[model samples]
Target: MRIVRSARAHIARYGEAPSFRELAAAVGLSSIATVSYHLRRLRELGVIVETRGRVSARCPHCGLTP
Candidate 1:
């Protein structure tokens, strides 16, 4: 919950979604495994969604340009 919320907050401020690496770095989490677990949670919760690959792209279904 904390990771997802932190990530969402970061995105809300940055205007673009952060990659798992960026989000993890911002929140001080030390492992990609941990971030991956949390990211799955966020995806399942519908608070975030993954899409076609890019370093900092928002979902086509949601975001400023969508």
Candidate 2:
């Protein structure tokens, strides 16, 4: 999933999670709703998590927080 990969990379490079708009741009997505849809699915699958409006990979080995 590009969104997940991009989110992890963005956090690794910037030391913070990206906003939905930033993520949309990073993954070449034109709609924030699409990002939201994918995020929801990812969350349900335990591939990602959201805390206080920030999104991060669920795997601890990813070494990121949001």
Candidate 3:
């Protein structure tokens, strides 16, 4: 959940998604692969979605891309 939260915050603050390295650093993760794994799981859980090669968290209430 931290990664998703971080990603949403980063998008809000910067108007763009964070890269894997940036997301890892933001979440105190040292491995990009670990971030990748979590993101993959989030995608499967429908907590996040990938569009046009970009990943973003979905609005929990409406399930819309944020």
lDDT of 1 by residue, 1-66 (tens): 566556556667876667777877877988978888867775676655666531232334446231
The TM-score that candidate 1 achieves is 0.61
Tens-digit lDDT string for candidate 2 (1-66): 899899888888988888888899999999999999999998998889887677776656666565
Q: How many residue pairs clash per model?
A: 0, 0, 0
Model 1: weakest 10-residue lDDT segment is 53-62
Q: What TM-scores do the predictions have?
A: 0.61, 0.84, 0.82
Give candidate 3's total backbone clashes: 0
Query: Per-candidate RMSD vs. true structure?
Result: 4.4, 1.9, 2.0
Poorest 10 consecutive residues by lDDT, candidate 2: 57-66
Give each model's whole-structure lDDT. Answer: 0.62, 0.84, 0.81
Please name the candidate that would achieve the greatest lDDT relative to the true structure: 2
As for candidate 1, its clashing pairs are none
Name the candidate, 2 or 3, with the larger lDDT value. 2
- How would the candidate models be sorted by TM-score, starting from the highest? 2, 3, 1
Task: In model 1, state the lDDT of residue 18.
Answer: 70
Per-residue lDDT over 1-66 for candidate 3, one digit per residue giving the tens place of the 0 to 100 score: 798889888888888777888889999999988998999999998788767656676757544455
Candidate 3 lands at a TM-score of 0.82
Model 1 misplaced stretches (Cα beyond 4 Å): 53-66
